[model samples]
Target: MPTSSPQPPPPADGLLSAARRNLREVAHGLTHASHPPTPLFADAPRPWQRLLPYGVVLALAATLIPVTINFLISEYGVPGGVAGALGVAQAAPLLMLAHRPLQAWWIVFPADIIGALVLLGYPVATYTVWPWTPPAIVGYLFLLLALGLRETRRTSIAVWLATGAAGVVLHVISPGRSNGSALLLPVLGAVVLVIAAAVRERGDAQRRLAEQETISEAERAQRTLLEERTRIARELHDVVAHHMSVITVQADSAPYRISGLSEEAVEEFGSIAASARESLAEMRRLLVVLRSDGTEGERAPQPGLDRLQQLVEATVRAGLPAELSLAADLGDVPQTVDLSAYRIVQEALANVVRHAPGARTRVSIASDGEHLTVVVANDRAERLGSPLEPTGTGHGLVGMRERVRLTGGTLDTGPLPDGGFRVAARLPLSPASPSSLEDL
Candidate 1:
């Protein structure tokens, strides 16, 4: 017996297999047509406008239902009851456009093909071809406009070009040309794109405006704080000037009041009085500038590293036991930088005196020609015999930060590991003045 070759599949089986494959392709397309992040149809300010799209989609589907039924019953000679059912089936996918737009497009392509093959008529007596029937135009135009709003510009443009190419191909192959309005589709798409662009630009402008308002508020607060600091400096100048004036007078008159005073003692008294008077004059000049409405003048000489020893001794006398260390030589630091450094040390020591009473404090200064680093640390407060807890304004750190910011410096302050507190700052050095090195 000869071996038999495998029999070819029958026509019915082959057709069924092809139909299943087409169904799978449609399902895959519909499932993969993603919903966009920013959807085109969304809630509108007017309640009716939000519902208008749904109403239009339903109306389009309804019109197509009657057209499908007439083609099935009158043209194809199907039973009236079955034709009604088939019409409902045909309208179902088009109605789905309101929810699954891309999926509905996928469904429409095959539905139109099947309708032409089965019904054997042209859009139920509409003059247009089965593919570009009135309902089909509505569906395609709506989908294109919606995609322009929902998807990104690149994706929308690609889809629009593809749709145009498909239309051109269909028009060339069809027996009759489509209606003349077919040429206006691109213009309609451009209009939709313009609307979407305007909406996006308006949203961006609003966001930028909100950010600018926040920045303006922050700058206003900073300006107010600096003004307050200047005012305090002006008021304190009077107290300092009075004490210096008293010291100058007392030192100048001391030699005459004492009998049998040595010549060296008299000379020392005169020198002490002169120095006090000079300091008093400088203080008065700086205060006048600070209080004046005038904009331009030379500022009084600011204290620098030369005054560090005096500041430390004064802090000690005020009952903050502070030790000072200079890790590197001060080499011609700028006057502003020098003044900022002195103020930082002064404020840190003051905080320790008020907040960390009886705490052993250490002050360290290091400079490497380009930058200066200052560190002040104090141990936790331990109640001593006589308590002198001065009330603080609580703006010491704020003032320190302002000073550091003015000098283009960075500051870090926090508690130490051993129940102590530390403040560290690094300031950029500026060009040294003529007397900067001499003062240091």
Candidate 2:
């Protein structure tokens, strides 16, 4: 049998350790967790809103003091000085609560005890020690709410319990003219505490909710920006892929088209074509990631001048009658130029579809051997359907300008005098090297 290790001896200062643990628990229980304080009248409340609370409370305090003093002087026959002083003590603390709530709380109980004794001792004891008189009730209600707003629940509970104990002592020692109000005061105090707690909790919840909404809005803006960047990247990838495809085609057919003499020349051409094809393949994989829908199959090729007819036909089918005209020999144009030329028309036509619905559109492409020009013009809509809404935010023209710029091109777009819109782009037909295409 394996021998068990001896148990550690109890702490030498076991009693002291237990006492420390008990003190920690007591402190934790007494000190309630709290957040940054939110005053009922905030630090920077509007002038009117801030003044309203102070004005209302001061008015109540003013009214309560005079009425209580008059009652004491007329009915209880207390000295004028004593009545006035007691009334001031009871009501003055309420005024202090306007600025310093917790400090005001400390003053209320002492004022009440003094007022009750002055009334009971001199006059024939009309009411109990802590009677729920109108003035007393109003004062307690205000103090309870102010304390709940500015302090923690533990502090409020401690005050509430202490008030109840004081009332109990008053009832036992000198039960006076009426005990009914004595019972009512604590019940009403409990209700006021509940309402104050509810209000404070609601304020905390609203603050938390507002914070969450702000975070969500920021996240949404960031997501929109990322999506726009991805779209731009995908378009540039199309530009790169188009050039790479052309390089592959030209390299493969070089030896066959140019009557090459050396076998080494043929092998070199074959290597160039193979490398171009591999680069194109890698770019296509990246495109898949950019435009992923979880399908692992070949995507259709990027559109060029050859697909102009198909695009026009599709536009017609979508209810925007469009006409296409190729005025120059676009067949010999470089692939990047061909692609930019196509996208310019495509975006312009899309804009026509969106902004000038039911308008006749003309797409024209021309090349002067050095530059390729594309023009897409539309007339004002004769029959306006609801204009097509873009899937992305309003960056359509910005995207067009960017595409033209990347291809060493210029774009001009504006409204025409005929109440229509025109978009034109001229792309340089510079023949980029295969290595440059690979880098793109």
lDDT of 2 by residue, 1-440 (tens): 99999999988899999988866754563344343334356644487876776787788788888987887677677789988887887777788665666666667778886766665665455342234456776787888887777677877787788778877777776775445666677778888889989998998898889899999989876675556556656766866777788999999999879984489988998999999999988988888888747644435666679989988998888888889988746557766666667766777787887778889999888888778888899999977668865332225675576566656678888899999988889887886445433422
Tens digits of per-residue lDDT, candidate 1, 1-440, equal 99999998788788889988866764554446545432234545686776777787788787877886776666556578866765665565666555566656556645544443444433434443443444444555666555544444555565566556655655565536454334455566566657756776676597689889999989877766766467446544654665688999989999878889899999999999999999988987887778758754334644678889998988888877889998657787765667678878887887887777889999999988888999999998877454565433325787677666656778999999999999999987874345433321
Candidate 2 stretches greater than 4 Å from native: 1-51, 96-99, 126-133, 172-182, 249-275, 294-440
lDDT of each: 0.68, 0.74
Per TM-score, the best of the predicted structures is: 2
Candidate 1 — worst ten consecutive residues by lDDT sum?
431-440
213 in model 1: Cα distance from truth in Å?
A: 3.4
Q: Clashing pairs in model 1?
A: none
Q: Considering summed lDDT, which 10 consecutive residues are worst modelled in model 2? A: 29-38
lDDT of 1: 0.68
